[model samples]
Target: MRILLVGAGLSGAVIGRTLAQAGHDCHVIDSRDHAGGNCHTERDAATGVMMHVYGPHIFHTDDAEVWDYVNRFADFLPFQNRVKTTSRGAVYSLPVNLLTINQFFRRTLRPDEARAFLECQADTSIADPQNFEEQALRFVGPDLYEAFFKGYTEKQWGCDPRNLPASILRRLPVRFNYDDNYFFHRFQGMPREGYTAMIRAILDHPGIATDLNTPYDPAMAGQYDHVFWSGPLDGFFGYRLGRLGYRTLDFERFDYDGDYQGCAVMNYGDREVPYTRITEHKHFSPWETHERSVCYREFSRAAGPDDIPYYPIRLVREKALLEDYVRLAQATPGVTFVGRLGTYRYLDMDVTIREALDTGRDFLARAAQGRSPAAFVHAPL
Candidate 1:
C-alpha cells in the first residue's frame, strides 16, 4: 500500500514509521524545512545551548505505552516542570498551590488550614458556575481569582474570562499542598538530543520517504491508496467555509551573558505586563552547561493568514466553523484527519502520539481485511 502522510510532526512521523514498519510505502511531507512541527528544537550556534525554537515542551504523560514508545527513538533526561508566576509585585508558585496561597496572603498556613481558609473565601452565592470567571469565583473567590487568574487569563486568551469556557479553568488545579510539580504524571522527561532528532529517527524506516518544504496538493491524493492529513482542518479544504479561530505566538529572542531568569518558565500574571511568559531555553536542558543563555518572551494574539497557528480558539464562533469542516471531512474519501490541527483541539505530546499509533494500527488492520477506514480515527466534532 502506498500512504501519503502530510505534516511531519509527531503525528505524521509516528504514523509513517508504523506503516513503513508494516511493509507499506510511506511518503511524509512537511511545509517547514525541518520535522517535529511545533516541538522542533536545535542547539544555538553562538551559545551552544539547546534551544526550543517554538517554545518549551516538557514531555509528561501517565501512559506507559507512549512513554516506552518515545524512549525507543531517543534518550530522555528526567525533567520535572516547576512553573512560576509573578502577580502584582511578588513571584509565586503556579497551579495555586499551598505555597502560592500562603505567599499571596502573607500567611503561613498548613495544608488543612489552607483548605479551610480557601473554603471560607469561596463564594457560596454561586450554586452553579457558568464560565471561567464564575468557576474561579466559586472555587477560589474573587481576591485570589483577581490576583492570580483574571489578569493572566485576559492576557493569554485576549478575552474576558466571563466569555471563556469553565472547562479551561477546570484543567488547572488548586492544590492545598506545597508540591509545586506542574504536572502530575508518572513519566516526565525531555529528549536529551532534541525533538527533531527523535522524530528523524522515527522516520528513518527503509520503506519511508520524506520531502520537506513541500506544500500539500489535493491532486496528489489520487496517487496514494490512503492519505493521512495532520494539517489545519480548514486549510485542507482551502478555507471555503471560513477560517477557524486560532491564537498564534510571537517570540522576542535575546541572548544574555549568564542565566537571564533563574527558572525555565515565568508567567507574568499582571495584565500590565506585555508578554505572557519568559522562557530561558538553556534551563530546559540543565544537564548541558553554557556560559551564555538564550531566552524568549512570548506574546499571544489572533492568528493571521501568514502566522503559524499555535493555540486553537474553540469559542462559540470557531466551534460552529469547525463543525462545517468536520462534515466536509466526513464526506471526503481516501482521506483521514489526525493530530491537534486536524482535530482542532489542544492536545499534549502524549495524546498526539497515542492517537497516531492507534490510527496507524487501525489502518493496517483495515487493509488486511480489505476494507476502507473512516475519515477520522478520533472525531473532531
Candidate 2:
C-alpha cells in the first residue's frame, strides 16, 4: 500500500514508521522546513544550548509502552518540571501547593489544617460550577484564584475565566502537600538530544520517504492508497465553515550571562505582566552547563491567518464548527484524521503518539482483512 502521511510531527512520524515497517511504502510531507512540528528543537549557535524553538515541551507520561518507544530513539534525561510564579511582588511555588498556601497566607498549616482552611475559604454558594472562574472559586476560594489562576488564565487564553470551560481548571492541581512537581506522571523527562532528532530517527526507516518544506496537495492524495492527516482539520476542508479558534504563542528572546530565573519555567500570575511565562533553555537540560543562557518570554494571543496555532480554544462555537468538519471528514474517503490539529483537541505528546500507533495498527489489520479503515481510528467528535 502507498500511504501519504501529512505533517512530519510525532503523529506522522510514528504512523509512517509503523506502516513502513509493515512493508507499506510511506511518504511523509511537512510544510515546515523541519520535522517535529510544534515540538521542534535546535541548538543555539551562540550558547550551544539545546533550544526549544516553539516552546517548552516536557515529555511526561504514565504509559509504559509510550515511554519505552521514545527511549529507543534518543536518550531521555530525568527532569522534573518545578514551576514558580510571581504575584504581587512575591514568588511562590506553583500548583498552589501547601508551601504556596502557607507562604501566601503567612501561616504554617499542616495537611489537615490546610485542607480545612481551604474549605473555609471556598465558596459554598455555587453548588454547580459551570465555568473556569466558578470552578477555581469553589476549589481554592477567591484569594488563591485571583492570585494564581485568574490573570494567568486570562492572558493564556485571552479571555475571562468565566467564559472558559470548567474542565480547563480541572487539569491544574491544588495539592495540600508540599510536592511542587507540576505533573504526577510516572515518566517525566526531556530528550537528551532534542525532539527533532528523535523524530528524524523515527522517519529514518527504509520504506519511508520524507519531503520537508512540502505542503499537502489534494491531488497528491489521489496517488496514495490512504492519507493520515496531522494538520488542522478545518484546513483539510479549506475552512469553508469558519476557522476554528486557537490561542497562539509569541516568544520574546533574551540572553543572560549566567542563570536567568534559576528555573526551567516561571509563570507571571499578575495581569500586569504581559507574557504568560518565561522559560530558560539551559534549565530544561540540567545535565549540560553553559557560560551564557537563552530564554523566551511567551505571550499568548488569538491566532491570525499566518500565525501557527497552539492551543485549541474549543468553546461552544468552535465545537459546533469542529463537528461540521468531522462530518465532512467521515464523508471524505481515503483520509484518516490523526493527532492534535487533526482531531481538533489539546492533546499531550503521549496521547498523540498512542493514538497514532493505534491508527497505524488498525489500518494494517483492516487492510489485511480486506476492509477499508475508518476516517478516524478514534473519533474526534
Candidate 2 structure quality by residue, lDDT tens digits, 57-100:
99999999999999999999999999999899999998889999
Give candidate 1 regions above 4 Å deviation: none
Q: Give the candidate number with the greatest lDDT.
A: 2
TM-score of each: 0.99, 0.99
lDDT (C-alpha) at residue 78 in model 1: 93
Model 1 pairs whose backbones collide: none
Question: Any runs in candidate 2 off by more than 4 Å, and if so which?
Answer: none
Positional deviation of residue 178's Cα in model 2 after best superposition, in angstroms? 0.9
Candidate 1, residue 81: how far the Cα is off, in Å: 0.6
